[model samples]
Target: MKNIIIAIAFFFLSYTNAQDKKIYALEFYSWVGANDNISYEMASIIFDSNLDSNDYYCNNKEYNALIRVKYSEKGVEKIFDYNAYVNILYLDNQTEIQNKNGAFYTMIIDGYAPAKLIKGNGSYNPDNFVVSGIVTKNTPRILNAYHLDDAEFLQQNIKNASVKPEYINTTDEGRAKIKKFFSSTDEMYRLLMLYIANFD
Candidate 1:
């Protein structure tokens, strides 16, 4: 009995050792711009190819980019491997994924993922963890999006809170009141963009 148990354990260990998992590096880039003007986007990911079906990582789709990196940064010398998952969104150009700049549709990567099977629950989930918002062309020096830190946000909110709250409206009367200040029509665009008070 003891010998049989030892043999089984050894076999399990051997099988586990045989399964070699490869961690591939992926460079997810996109065109970071609004309408006409556009720029490049960069964000790296050391993916542990553990998923059973990871065909998406390979150069199987248009978004799957086989990037041959030549430059080196910090210590992680750019892994000249197949990188992709850039143009996930098919907004305008469906035929073309990307041209000289970037991709057609940028995947909205946020913190969310699909969970394990919930037995009876069929709908399951469609949320995953992903933070690619600031994955712009440049680093902190020149961030693509305008982001306010907690400290800065608190400071501004506190300062504004001290003063009597002035709520602006977007209706005709509100626009008329705002226009009476002898201001430009461009300011009307800012009517909807408002800053709320700090929640208790």
Candidate 2:
């Protein structure tokens, strides 16, 4: 029994090491709409040459926080890896929130699979966790999308919570009022986009 246990542990460790080296997200320099914008979208798993099915970190689609990344020529070299890209998402998303205080705006929400599940040999559970309100900003401004830390709350109130946004720009105070009324979710940004796309 002891030898068997030791062998299993060794195998698990070796497998994890191998998985850590793999590039899991598919990045693209493609164009969307007519903005001449270059973007990168990541998936939990890159479908084997076929692009047929995704091997998600979590089976639940909502938990996956992968978003298309946009880069200008000036910022292209800066986005060389996941760390830089993710940091940009955080900073840009916050900036959008701060800047849009006095304008008519829309907000989108979305989620991301927890970091643990993104591991090389990690297991997934559907009900594990989620973040909503991934995207939010004034329409013309079109702030970046992102996953926040409290999406699980929205899952409970999803029926009423997933409503289309109204662009109201009274003032910074007004934007704060709007944000305060809605419970921010990790998936806010993506959900907002879905709400707009479906309703519009």
Candidate 3:
């Protein structure tokens, strides 16, 4: 009886360890309009057990989330060393999980302004660009923001999908033109879900 009890405990411990060793998949998808000129890329970052030990930095206090990710693009695979701000949404219901299946977490990364370029000679040049994206266990949809405020503006007005190109321009006059064109965040979200659904 003693030997049987020890074996059962060992089996239970092994099963628990196996369950704890889960690895989540991170996927990415990007869309650029014909008229939109933006260059950006996304990578999954895995951090040490402690969240604060990574290299990536997040300005927002609430967004300091990191995980281990195996990022693959164009037939190339690489691991990220830094940490970044990510919002994770956990699906509780099995129906919800199956509805948008396979994704265990949803992460959103916002872009900021005042882009800079480093030359091989160690010289820095001015390159003003912003890249932002929404990531999930299966897909990440990235987009370029015209200016520093573009991402914030889009998030604030996500319900109003009539965003015009002029509004994204980095100018006071352009900001005023935002009302002229509206775009739907729900629509964009649906499109993203569709992309993931079709992905193999």
Q: lDDT values of the candidates?
A: 0.29, 0.30, 0.32
Task: Output candidate 1 Cα RMSD.
Answer: 24.8
Ranking by TM-score: 3, 1, 2
- Per-residue lDDT tens digits for candidate 1, residues 1-200, read 99999988986665454233222322333332222232322333333433355443232222222222122333332222223333233234423323323323233222113332212223222211122222123221111221112233366542211111122333444444333331342221232112111111
Better of 1 and 2 by TM-score: 1
- Summed over model 1, clashes come to 10
Which residues of candidate 1, in runs, are more than 4 Å off? Answer: 1-19, 26-97, 104-128, 133-200
Q: 80, model 1: CA deviation in Å?
A: 30
**Which segments of candidate 3 are over 4 A away from where they belong?**
1-30, 33-35, 44-83, 95-104, 111-116, 119-151, 154-200
Top-lDDT structure, candidate number: 3
**Any idea what lDDT model 3 has?**
0.32
Ranking according to lDDT, highest score first? 3, 2, 1
Question: What does candidate 3's lDDT look like per residue over 29-140, in tens digits?
Answer: 2223222343223322211233353422222223432222222334454332223444444333546546454333333433222222211122111111233434355343
Q: Model 1, residue 108: displacement in angstroms?
A: 8.0
Per-residue lDDT, model 3, residue 77, is 44
Q: Tell me the TM-score of each prediction against the true structure.
A: 0.20, 0.19, 0.28
